[model samples]
Target chain A: MNDLVENVVKGDIRAVARLIRDIDDGIPGVREALKALYPHTGKAYVLGITGSPGVGKSTLVDQMVSHLRRKEKTVGVLAVDPTSPFSGGAILGDRVRMQRHSLDEGVFIRSMATRGHFGGLTQSTRSAIDVLDAMGKDYIIVETVGVGQDEVDVVKSAHTTVIVVIPGMGDDIQAIKAGILEVGDIFVINKADREGSDKTLSDLRLMIDMDQKKYEDGGWKPPIVKAQAVFDKGVEEVLEEVEKHRAYLLETQGEIDFRRSPKRVREELMDLVKNRVIEEVLGKLTETGDFDAAVEAIARGEKDPYSACDELVLPRLEIH
Target chain B: MTGKRRIRIMVAKPGLDGHDRGARIIARAYRDAGYEVVYTGLHQTPEEIVEAAIQEDVDMIGLSSLAGAHNYLFPRTVELLKEKGADDIVVCGGGIIPDEDIPTLKAAGIREIFTPGTPLDVIVKWVADNVEPRGEY
Candidate 1:
């Protein structure tokens, strides 16, 4: 397995990218690669910044990167957007706003699109993060776009989750209460310069207070911070709170453990295993000419998808 | 299919950018082009995306980010993918990419940049030509 990518670290851009390509394609020799780099998986503190559209998550990330650079910590930011099917491209308009941190040696930024995979849930992403960790990035920030309540699901793997909010978005607190509130490690009310900032903060406080009863974890609670991301206001405070949360996790291992329960592990494991099995079975099914027949049957309503999936599909994927 | 290992691809979307039209199209293109495409639904964390790559045993991850969230999502994907020892996967990017960020994207370990107006043949050819699926032996 002496491929060009073995024993490669992440200091350079092309090397890391090539490695990602190889891994993303599910080439055979990747187990050896991860086995070689297993020790570096948990070093980087992962920060997930998410909010409704127009909350200025990017501007906030810019400010955070600036602050991180001041402390001399290497930062890697991952921004995800959508691509055009016709053109196979992205505007990446967000990156255009954060050019200030692009040239900094310690800061690296990249924009990714789902590029027509079922969703942007690519395994290459996991490997990419490891590469950055192995490269010694102290902070890794992933800014995700909100897709209603389900958007919060991605943050489950994050070490720290910052839910960004705008001031005048009418019921910003309500949205938080609806979905993002419970997921927040720390809540950030961005665009604090706007009017109604107090109402938003107060409403958020009230919401947090309501959840106070459900939260039981050595008294761990998500804090709220206000910031005008355009001006980089309170960005440092936000970062500090993120650090505080990370430090809190380190100091209070009991909390992180409880949050990352067995159920969480099982769900992630199932997802991983399910996808892999489906790939193998799907390839076989297609190769054996059952795929199109199954599809046509489903399309023609000759059979139920569940039965088809369980019998023709699941049987093959069964480890037994 | 020849002696080459099938190209494994994890097609993922990182944020609330739920516009899956492009991501879906490319996933099909990759599939039709004879690559194994893994599609994780919208609003995936970078870590989740990376986890999918590792568990699925993929060789390349194609991410489609449309809501201007790529900067935060792509590098995070890169960082996690590398950490997990699947760094040999070529990370190719496609979306409404601005010309200015091309160098930055490349610098962030993007193997190849797929911009708007890129033909499907080009994308199909690029993956077929570049990515080699692991362990065909």
Candidate 2:
């Protein structure tokens, strides 16, 4: 462990931010930093917030962050936005909306761009969450862009997933596909003061009741929270429901450990293996000049890709 | 060894400067130039600006100050970054700075000061040419 890693584990604010920056840039020494800080993590409760773009997810997160802070729990927020594939430019305006916590030392807010990383999060977001966890934040909230099914990946990394829904929007409930519904541990009908709030609330309840498999492993029903986050209405009850869901998850330890954690761990391990295999094989091939020869042969029609891989690639790899 | 990565600049409004029209315009211009820009909202202190710059690991800090407090806020931001071993982060300022104060700000380590009517192309070109990430990526 280096001095910087040690400082990060000790909750040094500057060091924590610098370490996250390095990780985001894919700079060297981050592996060692993660290794040193890993033991200090797993203490923070992670919450995932997802919804449609106009559902005011940012406002809900801001209110939740304030609620957590008032309860004396330190909070860390990761607001993820999608990067423009054509321009590589992103307007990370979530921070502008959450300016209330900008000056609060107990709150740390960061905006991340999904630069080619799928599931509405950057490749560095998980690492940033770990860094925040190690930095001693009691609650870490990951707010996704919440556009499509791919954004559900945020739930895999969280202990609780809050899906925000707005009332009075045409075809609102139809947007909640099966994938999003399965991952939702709690449903929030924000903008509850709107005209069609009752219809949306009843609609969500009927769907949840019909989908029996979502609660098959346990008898816990996902609570429907009615919140007008803009006016700071019913946010406390929403927080209470979140806490209730957390308690339910704690009681169902077998499900969490066997079903959730194992799947997440396997995904992480596979990611590492895939990256390492690419790095090793490509690096060896480049060093030995076989890669170029294979490319040239394929271009010249002298060798097929299958033959090239069998002869040149298979001989060097030790996969079993 | 940045290696042709996107140049990220943090455009921050430090102190009580409520005039953010210039900063917002510059941010949009930089974005149109295909640079990633993180605009820290109004009323940011020097410490908060430095912290955000470090956290975002941006190539440059574009500070906008129109309240005649650049002497203290801008230098304090630079000083905090230096103290945190991030002196490599470029510091630039704009908005309402007088000509006489320009040399003093430069001496205090502001890379460039864009006053009123400074062309957007000049600022964009300066950042693209001068601001480089020090990270070993």
Q: Give the winner by DockQ.
A: 2
List the lowest-lDDT window of 10 residues for candidate 1 chain B.
B1-10
Q: Candidate 1 lDDT, tens digit per residue, B1-137?
A: 01134445778778778788888888777766655465766777777667545544567888888888777788888887778666876788889778888788779988787877899889879886788765331
A65-110 per-residue lDDT for model 2 (tens digits) = 9999999999999988777777676667677667667668888888
The DockQ figures for the candidates are 0.05, 0.39
Find the 10 residues in a row with the least total lDDT in model 1 chain A: A114-123
RMSD (Å) per prediction: 10.8, 4.1
Clashes of each: 96, 0
Model 1 residue A305 distance off true place after TM-score fit, in angstroms = 3.6
**Residue pairs in clash, model 2:** none
Candidate with top lDDT is 2
| Candidate 2 ranges beyond 4 A from true positions | A117-123, A213-217, A254-260, A275-320, B1-6, B15-21, B32-34, B66-73, B79-86, B134-137
